[model samples]
Each structure stands twice: as structure tokens, then as C-alpha cells.
Target: MAGQKGDPVMVDERRFTSFADGETSLELHGLTFENGTDALAVYGNGVFTRDAAGRAALAAVVDVLRRAVAALDEAGPAAQALPDGDGRGDGATSVANPFG
Candidate 1:
């Protein structure tokens, strides 16, 4: 939501999920705007997996996303969906989307 000069603002929000397939996760989102800017600033963070093993794997995924975001920020465009590593006969494994 946006407001003129000195107007107050409010927001309504909620999150609903279908199932829990992976480790533990939590999400937080917020909106803010610059003093003289017309565009709104949106920010969010999704922490996945509090479990020891899951945390380690999730951390690696975080690193991957960090690099992907940096590339976009520097090149003024978005990065396409790319695999983290070569799939060397892992059979069937589900891929997780941290952004969602």
C-alpha cells in the first residue's frame, strides 16, 4: 500500500501451504518505500530447514541463490533456471524452490 505526503497505511496478509515435504521453513515479508521515490521496495527472507543435515544442504542452496541474485543485480537482467550441479544418476529426487 502507498500513501500521500503524511497519510497512514495498513496491510493484510497470510500464508497457506499444501504440505510439508522437506525440512523446517519460515518466511517473512515486508514492504517499504524511499522518501522521494515512486516505486515500492519489497523484501523477504525464507529460511529452510532447522535440522542439522537439512541446514547444511539448505545453506549450499542459499549460496547458489546469492550468486544468481548478484548476477541479475549486476547485469540488469534475470538469471534463467539452472541446475546446481550435474545430475549423475541420482535417480529420482525432488527439487525445491526457495523463492516460493
Candidate 2:
């Protein structure tokens, strides 16, 4: 997200990719601000269970996401997300959580 390093940006696309081994490892893919510029990836180690600390961190993150979703309904990606360039604002969302 080098181009998005300055101003606050949003994800335009997101999905998850998993390994064929069915292990507890997965990837989170996100295209930020615009397509073909930069990306954001979050990896989760399924092999490792979440400790108290990890759970706490995840809880905090979820809380913030909740707040942002409530506050930035028209702005933030999570609240009003749509597929890249679709531009319909149809409130459709794609989730690829193989972890679950």
C-alpha cells in the first residue's frame, strides 16, 4: 500500500486463500484504496491456538471494527463494501473465512 501510505485508505477487494493441506494456516488478501496499486495481507497461523494475549488483541480489533462500522457507514470499507468497480453500493459482501 505504498501509494496509500499517506492518507487514510480503504480496502477495495478482499478474500482468503487457504492451502490444500487443510492445516491451520491461511491468508487474508485485501486491495487497498484502489485495485492494482497495493495490497494488504493478514496471515493467521491455524496451527497455533490463540492464547489469552492473542484473544485479547483480537477482541480489541473487533471492537474497533465495530465502532468504525457504526461511525463510517458511508465512508469505511467494512460498512459499505462492494466489489471493486461495481459501484452499485448494493451492500454485498464477500467473506472467505476458511479458518472457520
Candidate 3:
């Protein structure tokens, strides 16, 4: 969303997924956004079992790195898919846009 001079615009969130079980279990999520800059701003965190965390963490990092490189050519963190496009694309974000 955009602001209109003084009107508050609906937040154009760079949403991502997360999972958790109470406070002692696990949580995982990632997010990104396009500011008025040359690239997208991104941040994220995840929690998982020590037994499996390594694989999952590596997978997520590898994914974002690959996607960012492909999408932004290492200029800035960036990866987004068209609303209609579907594939293993865009930092592992879900390709099917239910919102669209």
C-alpha cells in the first residue's frame, strides 16, 4: 500500500512463513520488501531441533543466496515471483499466490 500525503497506506508487508509449538518448540520465518532503494530489504529467523536444524538452515540460506543472485545479480537482496508464475523459484517462497 501507498500513503496519500497524510493518509496511512495499508502496509505493503513483505510477509513470510513461520512455525512454532508453544514457546519451547520451534519457530521459523522470513520476510522481505522493496523500499525506495535499488533492492529489497530482507530479514528472517528460524528455530528448529539441533538434529535437523543444520540441513534446514543450510537449505534456506542456499535458497535465498541463489534466488538473490539470480534475481538481483548480487546488487542487493532480491527475489520475487510473478503472481501467476509457478515453479521452485524466488527464495523458496510459495509460487501459488492465493492473494492474487
Candidate 4:
């Protein structure tokens, strides 16, 4: 976990993979911005085997995500707003079909 120490990790946008699983009830994706950067998004509940290593790994993932969120917060509201285009070129600001 690169953000374990509360430091923001600069992850490349190209490494993202769209993921969804009904069994685990979880989804992971990368929301790309018009500026060509992407943000990782994890949604819904997650299930993992109960074990010490699993716990530690989950903690690390949480730490990294927290750091990323904190960094975004520090960037202020302008940085938080969605970039232009919305990837559809229809001038839509909100998500049209998130599950698709």
C-alpha cells in the first residue's frame, strides 16, 4: 500500500480495470476525467476470508484510499468537480448508467 503513511500515492490512470461481482456485492472502477486522469472507485460491500493476512491487507487498502480522499479534500471544491465531456459528449454531468 503506497499511502500507508498518510501520503497520497500518484497512481497511473492506465492501470485501472472495470470490475463487478454479484457474489461479493462489490464493484471497482476507474472514472476517467477529461484531463486524461482517472480516479479509482470501489463501491458496495466486500467479503474476504477471515484471516490475519486478509485483515492486514484490507487495512492497507483502506489506508491508501483514505489518503487519496484526504488529498482530494485538500485540493478543494474546484478539484472535486467533474471534468468536462463526461465521456459521452452529450453534456451530461451526472452518471447516466453507472451499472452498465
Candidate 5:
């Protein structure tokens, strides 16, 4: 989107259209779970503009998101490994003991 220098930048909004055919795929027995995904295509017919700083900032944001996602993935297994406090595991001992 472009306009006079003094004018506010207005992004030319375009409606998104999607077409999908019925398809099915089987999942493998074991795979690391990844939660989110994005697919984007930016193209224009006649003219285009590039903003290096803006692109760099966008990349930085994506990197931050990836790290955040990795941290969440790492936390999930640890959380699952912990006992659920119903006194059902060998991981943690009960509070009533002979050491009193």
C-alpha cells in the first residue's frame, strides 16, 4: 500500500479465499507435536515495495515466537512427568513418616 508521504499508510485490505478438496492422511505412531502453522504468499502484478527494517523486525518477532513455543514444548513433558498429588507414584514420598 502506498500514498503521499504526509498521508497515513493504509494497507490495501484484500479478502481471502480458500479452496480445499476432501483429503485424508494417516498419522505416524510417534512424532513431536507442533501446535501452530502459517502459510503466506505475497505477490503483486505491477509494482512492489521493500522495507528492510520492517522485514527485520518481523523476523525478530517470529524468532521470539519460536523460542516461546519451544519453551512451552519443553515444559509440557516435565508437567506430564510430575505426580498428580493423588498419592499414586514412587516419585514423591508421603508426609507421614518416622522422622518426626
Candidate 6:
């Protein structure tokens, strides 16, 4: 469903929202797995993990996440500052989709 400019919208139980500033903008969305195949679904991108290569791709993503978490831990507090003054920057923005 459509929402006001800044409000989160839900489509098929997946939530969508975005944030922006002068230099950059980010859109947030959810992924759902295919019922029987357990493939990860992405809008305009099709599904993943339905085959061996797809599963490997998903594992790669997980490995990257683990590495990133370790990196952030090594960086400590200085890496977590945000303009919003919220301490949640680490928890919220820590993982990024290496795929896109």
C-alpha cells in the first residue's frame, strides 16, 4: 500500500520505508521465502536459493555479514556515530546488502 512520503508501507506483509539527506538516500524493504523451495524472494529481481548456485550465493552473503560484524567490533564506538545522535546506528546500519 502507498503511504505518505515518509511513512512505512506494507505490501504482502513486508514493510517498506526510506530515508534521505542531501547526499544520499536509502530504501528499506523486506524479503520473503518461497513456501516450498525456501527461495528468497526479491521484487524485480526474482527468487534465490532454489538451486545449488543460489544457495552458495546466500551463504556468501552470510559470510560477508559475519566479516562486517567483526570489522565493526574492531572499529568500536568511533565507527557508530550518526547525525541523529542515536546510539542505534551500530545496531541499525551495521549490515549492508553486499549484493547490491
- Report the lDDT tens digits of candidate 4 across residue range 1-100: 4443235333343221112111221222222211112433444555544898668656645654666555445556765685655545345366578688
Order the candidate numbers by lDDT, best to worst.
Answer: 4, 6, 3, 1, 2, 5
Clashing pairs in 6: none
- List residue ranges in candidate 3 displaced over 4 A: 1-37, 47-49, 74-100
| Cα-based lDDT for every prediction | 0.33, 0.33, 0.35, 0.42, 0.31, 0.36
Tens digit of per-residue lDDT, candidate 3, span 1-100: 1111222112233232111111221122343322222233444554434667667665554454344344333323333432443433344664687788
> lDDT tens string, model 2, 1-100?
1112122222234222211122222221221111111222233432323688666545533443343333334445653563464333334477799899
The sequence of per-residue lDDT tens digits that candidate 6 reaches over residues 26-55 is: 122223222111111223342455789778
For each candidate in turn, give its C-alpha RMSD to the true structure in angstroms.
Answer: 18.4, 13.1, 17.4, 10.4, 18.9, 16.4
Deviation from truth (RMSD, Å), model 4: 10.4
lDDT of 1 by residue, 1-100 (tens): 1222222222233221111122222232221221111112223444556688667555544443343244334433322433354443234467898899
TM for every model, in the order presented, reads 0.26, 0.27, 0.30, 0.38, 0.27, 0.30
lDDT, candidate 5, equals 0.31
The numbered model that scores best in TM-score is: 4
Please name the candidate that would achieve the greatest lDDT relative to the true structure: 4
| Candidate 4 residue-wise lDDT at 66 | 68
lDDT of 5 by residue, 36-96 (tens): 2221122223221257765654453334334433433455666366445543323555687
Q: Order the candidates by TM-score, highest first.
A: 4, 6, 3, 5, 2, 1
Candidate 1: misplaced stretches above 4 Å?
1-49, 76-100
Please identify which of the two predictions, 1 or 6, would achieve the higher lDDT against the true structure. 6
Q: After aligning candidate 3 to the native by TM-score, how far in Å is the CA of 29 from where it should be?
A: 3.3
User: In candidate 2, which residue pairs get closer than 3 Å at backbone N, Cα or C atoms, i.e. clash?
Assistant: 24-46
